[model samples]
Target: MPSAEAPAAAAMDGEQRLHPWSWLFVLLQQLRQFVLPLVALLVFGGGGGREAQWQALAAAIAMVVLVAVSLLQFFTYRYRVGADGVTIRSGWLQRNLREIPFNRIHNVTLHQSLLHRVFGVAEVRLESAGGNKPEAQMRVLGLAAAQALEDVIRHGGSDRAGRTPDAAEPADVPLLALDTADVLRLGFISNRGMIVVAVAFSALWQIFPERVASRWVEQHAQQLLGYATSMHLGVLSTVAAVGSLITFGLLLTRVLSMLLALTQFHGFRLHEQPQRLTVERGLLARLRTSVSRRRIQSWTLQEGWLQRCLRRRNLRIDTAVAETGNRSDARALKELAPIATPDACDALIQHLLPHAQWPMPAWSPLSASMRWRLLLPTVLVLLVLSVPAWLQAGPWGLCIWLWLPWAIYGAWQQTRRAGYAVDTALVAVRGGWWARYWRFAEIDKLQALRLSHSPLDRRCGTASLWLDTAGASNMQPPLRIRFMPEVQAQALYRQLSAALAARRLRW
Candidate 1:
């Protein structure tokens, strides 16, 4: 129970083993990965009487085997904290040693669940650029030891620096803090609850017996119909009932989303240190992570219609932290600002990228004929869709043509709002109509620039410019400017290429 400094100092010398209880955590981690299969086994494999008892015993044996394996791992895993980096050696039958340099580490994450906190232990993960998995994962370390290790890595642990692990450093500058209100706004703006529901439904479909599920649904449907018949309900009453049910479902999802937000960002705080940025959050499970400021590769400012109406926006960044096999890595590294006012978001940008000039005055519009170019595709799609509707409904199907006006409006609005901005330090593209976003990157971060013209674009005398950055997320919109005049697109591409050539890529 010593301070973080004590463990850090201790770790700096010879090789060290994990906390004694590390196996417990390792067991739990393994269980989590196979939880579904285990549950299915318990429910389906276990028959009544002796069969159930035998199945239960088998499951217990499996758990005991897992525990034994975890213990073996704990006994085998050893790490050494040196001046330059940490060397991890692990294996039972076959020995494996990995040396992770501090300078190459892109992300240092510490996680503590409720149980881990009770045990005064934490899990540590180290990630580097372009790696498919975490460079190192320490299952259980003393809370202090984990922080000390994180601090050492953050401060550059090379031997030549001759730096003390516990040396006092610059105070963390407050960047952004989320209050209950901010979390609520984020919950309302996000569709996480719906996603959770969909996932739950999918899981049930996979795990639940189809006959049982169908029987339950049939019983409920029959009861509802009987009740309606007894009440002599008309179409209006049925419609009202359905409307109420839909409203309730929506409310339930929103409430779930809010609860999720509360747990995830209960005490979310982003802070800036001398060399890196740090974030700490969560209610039941605490997460603390840091990424070097220079490691950020691209920035995104997003505002859906809901966010816009709520007067909030989400600011995200792509970091050099590689996309890892761990799903949680994406959630941890992507969000820079989950929810904030426009002005606050801009302030954060200004503080982080002082050279780039946070708020570019005005974005240059795309080609004047961009609307026509956009509309052409919409017209073709609608024409195809209208045929189906007309075939089905005959005269009534012609009403599908009415959708053209909305499509036209959408195309025009998108063209009007979509544009690109360039300055000495940054290149940004703005796009989307209802769900708008701005993607920008420092000129130096440009990995590649492509200027290409489609057949349609060529006929329209326009081109598209694609910008690529390291570690960019495919889920997010790309930094691409479409329907720009061919000459301007080519010029911008050349300018960005020159910028990339002149600078050394930092990340």
Candidate 2:
């Protein structure tokens, strides 16, 4: 007697269920809390001591009691999906109810651990653009069910006519996904060496005093020669051996810490949806970040040494949002999550501004003056490095010699890749070597534009135009397009000013 549409709707509703794996997680948590304390107590208690045995038993019993209470509390927790929002009910002593509206949900991420994968289940994390933590999370759910929920929210659910919601109609935006090639490109261009150096330096700071003392003792050993002859050989040798062991331990710890941090962030993925970009990464404690399109202020493309070899580039997007806010401000908030890859970045921007033109122009090479201007920074850095080396190694200290060619090459490549093109509504700039980047911005969104000339640049008849946007307030020099003809720079500035002025009037 029921209609065909009615049965289909019922089937969709039936697919939504509580994740079965929640029970396993609760059980594991309870076991860890109860068992670990008992094991610790037994390990530390002295054998055949009546007082220690009694004390250990009392601690273990207390831990078990606390864990039992927690398990009871967890059993009462439950969640349900409804027409307007998701409802969560929990707490044994005081029942709590919370609702999360569909519109407020930024992105739903399905995470699968090895255990979950084997069991064919996944955890669902609901992220909001405004919140400091997950807006809502369900620990276990069927993979199909999770996907269905994501689809429903992404498409705004079903209509009264019983037709499934159209995913493309509301935003008509294209989703951007990065391939493996893009991920490799991002990893190569990233400052992996710099990250490792920073981690190693921080670790060294923690153990520096001990290291310095040991080094001083070793270097001044001849000063202690008089004392060493009278001291027991065994004691002196033991002290030397312990110092060596400590130094080795410190070095190993620093290396491991750096490796862990670097490897964790190696493979990154930036997935673009209609309204937001989701950044998922890390080998441990995987991070899922949602960045809304409306919050983005500006974008940049970068390419470095390794990226050039792979013919790839990195893209960074800057968003506008206050990093600190109130608790309620935690519920939904704006974020600036940078994504890598120029092509994917361009796709995202084009979705946001479909009318804009791209790949505008590839002009002549960098002028002689521009090349020299870029080289000046390399020269300054070399001078700074040389001062210390010269003081330590005298006139023969050529340790800094190794960096000169690399610095010069980097400067040359940077100048060569720096170029810009302007159309009626959009402006594009291309730069970087290992990871090539092409940044596009609407002329209307540009807050300010200026043509700048250094004494060196002026003498060579070259100019650079800097573009500022509402986003990326912290960026140095904001938006810079280096090495341009003076005439072209002035013309581009005029056109951008006019477009921005028109946008203001319309708004």
Error (Å) of candidate 1 at residue 342 is: 0.9
TM-score, prediction 1: 0.93
lDDT for residue 358 in candidate 1, whole number 0-100 = 74
TM-score of predicted structure 2: 0.54
Q: List CA RMSD, all candidates.
A: 2.6, 10.5
What's the lDDT of the predicted structure labeled candidate 2? 0.58
lDDT of 1 by residue, 1-507 (tens): 221233356545788889999999899888998788777776766559998888778888989999999999999999888888989999999999999998899888888888998999989989888877889989999887787788778878733257564556668788999999889878877888999999998788667678877888899999988987899878998899889999999989998999999988888899887779888888888888888988999999999999989889999999876676566674456688999999999999998998888788778988658888888987788788888988899989878778788888988899889988888888888999999999999988878888888898888898988888888856479888888888888888887888888888766
- TM-scores of all predicted structures: 0.93, 0.54
Candidate 1 segments exceeding 4 Å error: 1-7, 46-61, 158-161, 164-168, 458-460, 473-475
Model 2 misses residue 357 by how many Å?
2.5
> Which consecutive 10 residues in model 2 have the weakest lDDT in total?
1-10
The sequence of per-residue lDDT tens digits that candidate 2 reaches over residues 34-123 is: 554455445544567798778868877876776566555447666655566666777778888877777666555666555666676656
Candidates in order have lDDT scores of 0.84, 0.58
Candidate 2 Cα RMSD after full superposition onto the native fold (Å): 10.5
lDDT of 1: 0.84
